[model samples]
Target chain A: MTLEILAFALAALLMLGGAAVVALTKDLMRLVVGLGAFLLGVAGMFLYYGHAFLATAQVFVYVGGVLVLVVFAVMVVHRANGGRPLVTSQHDIGAAAVAFGVSGMLVMSLRESVGGWLPESGTSGSSIAQELLGGHLVAFELLGVLLLVALVAVLLIVGPGERR
Target chain B: MTLLWGFLWGVAAVATIAGGAILGVWWERKVSARIQMRYGPQQIGPFGSLQMIADVPKLLFKEDIVPALADKAIFKYAPLFVFGPVAVSMVVIPFTAGWAPLNTSVGVLFFLAVPSIEVIAILLSAWASHNTLSTLGGLRATAQMISYEVPRSLAVLAIVLLAGSLRPLDVVAAWRWWWMPLTFVAFVIYFVASIAEMNRGPFDIPEAESELVAGYFADYSGMRWASFMMAEYGAMIAASLFGAALFFGGGWPFGGALGVITLIVKAILIMTAIMWVKWTFPRLRQDQLMSFCWKALTPLALVQLVVVGVVLVWL
Candidate 1:
């Protein structure tokens, strides 16, 4: 049990560390690498949660899909420019401060409201599916619609574009 | 006893890697050859069963070269990144009852998650090579993987819904009695998506040999190229294993040790089917590939998910 806890902690740390690297990296490609690491760590967390399906989905979708898109976009945009600039203006101090403040407040509020209580529901994959399809059917259906809209939007954005 | 189990697991994994690669390569050649109306590797050994063995030593002894301008560090490690996770994923894949080396509740997830690392390895290899075509191939691969991933996830989610557990064993057990129509659809989606993800024929735009030389590995030669091939074949086998485990009641029709053999047989059958598709179908244009996933497969998967949800509730 202690070992499991340690493993979870390690996985969480790895995820946060990767996210920090992604947030802090100056190099655009390096940022993508960090994001990949972050996703991998999240996959580890999913494994810890005994949700291999979710973990695998996270790997297949976020790490494989999102990271690849980001890399391709970077390449495309970079090619449009003569070459990628070595440095950009480090002018996001204000934005960072606002983000930090918002995060702090959100964390504080969560702590105050929930008081460190974690749900102990032994909701297996089947039970979760039942809940999603039965009681939360409307919300589930709404997510499906949202996904469809997103798919169409992606097509419109990416398809039939002029080759640069 | 723990050490003995670990040793046995290690041996099983090594055998799986070597044997899977050998069989997958042979099957791919034979299927492609048959599709092209030619005999493949018939001269070497019985039905060319030993051809892959002959190629192994040649590949191993070949020169490992690196371009002068390439990032030496990443170039050296990229193949490991590609190959390691693939081997590791087999740990969680149960061939027969109580036979998995690293059986966990999240077995299916572990199996699925490991292959994404291959994308990173490819991207890094492309960048490290510092070649124009290689870079473009890497970029294209990334785009392809990302675009197809949505439908793939939805399909897997549908399976998870049906199985009610994340373990691959559980998935097989769930399908033992009766195959759900929704699960069957999910299986088809999963199979197609897995093929695309592996960059097989039709979806082999990233590595289109005639057009892009060798795609992302255009600059790679000798052992580096071999590593990439090994990874691709490993992934093919892994995907086949996953498909067999989930959709076909893995290791069924055979009991105990024979079940493991049966599981391999199932995977090989799937691999051959994929190869047949590869050799028969012409490659899809890049835009067509994207549209197929986003426009066609994605919606079908979504509808399947809804239908499954409804069926689960009412039935």
Candidate 2:
């Protein structure tokens, strides 16, 4: 029990530290890498909670899918030297204010939720699948439609080119 | 006690990764050399078997170079991100029945999920190096991985649907001899998607030498660079092991030590096939690579998944 707590605390520290770096860094590369670290740290926390499937999915979807998309977008718009920071000091105060407000609300909500937390762990992927297919089928179909719409929109925006 | 055992298993995993990487590298050189009609590493050891092993010391002893304008910390840790997940993925891979280090029920999903993390490492190293070519390479890699990952997962979805379980052993168990003919398409799609995902030959446009000039790792040197190479071979081994276990009947008709050997032999056979494809296929143009993945493989995998799901449900 003590060990799990220690592990969780360490993961939380890593997550927060990485998030701080992502928020504060001047370099665009560091900002993205910090975000990757932040995502991995979150994944670690999921693992600590015995959600191996979720942890792996977190790494797969965010670190692999979302972060790569973020980097690719940066590559297209950013300079060759990568010299500029994506976020500048002019935005810092406004960003900090928003961050604080969000954090305060989140903390309060978290406190409210903590009292009802379950002690046991481990949710198999099959159970999640069953819930998604059986109970949340409508939501699942909606998500699929949403993703399909997004794909079509992107295709319409980019348009097709000459095929080989 | 669990913590101590986990630590020990982690150490063992790392050692296996390092050793397996060396062996894979050597095997690649030999196979490619044979295909190209030349002797590879003949002087280093018997049949040049120790060449990659010898290169380890050389890579370690070489001076590590960081680009002058590079983000030093990001550059340093980038390779770790590339290799670490590949190493950690060893835990969920089943050698035989009840033999995996961590026998989580989500083993199939976990296997598919882990190696995709390498793109982050590539993107980081490329961006942090402050080189235009490196950045381009990184962008190419990111695009390639993102495009192929969808189909890769979709292809695996067929297997998961057929097996009705996410565990590696269960997926293997669902396969009978007759089922092989039907599932072969998914296997091929998975194999090709994996090749693209691993950024190997034909899809090796990310680091096309004539174009990008070593691509993302152009500025990386010494042990830092070695880490990236190790990561690539590690991914190869993992992918091959996965293909073997999932598609090639896994370690069956045996148990215990013999089962482990059978599993490895199956994996190596798949590795040989990968090597053959690597040596034979010419590199695809960047645009062609993207189109082939998005326009061809993705739709095929989606169709395969649907067919499998339908068949599983109805017949």
lDDT of 2: 0.83
lDDT of 1 at A102: 97
Give per-residue CA lDDT, model 2, range B253-305, as digits (tens).
67678878998998888888888998998999988988898899989998888
Name model 1 segments beyond 4 Å from true: A1-25, A42-61, A80-110, A113-118, A121-164, B1-15, B97-99, B156-159, B177-186, B306-315
lDDT of 2 by residue, A1-164 (tens): 88898889888988998998988787776788778779989999989877888888898899888888887888788887648556668877888999999999999999998775532343677666677787779999999999999999988777765234
| Model 2 bad stretches (over 4 Å) | A105-122, A143-164
Residue B228 displacement (Å), model 1 = 1.7
What proportion of the true contacts does each candidate reproduce? 0.50, 0.77
| Candidate lDDT (C-alpha), each | 0.77, 0.83
As for candidate 2, its clashing pairs are none
Provide TM-scores for the models: 0.80, 0.91
- Looking at candidate 1 chain A, the ten consecutive residues that score lowest on lDDT are A80-89
For A20-63, candidate 1 gives per-residue lDDT tens digits of 98777676666676787788888889778776556666886787
lDDT of 1 at B199: 83
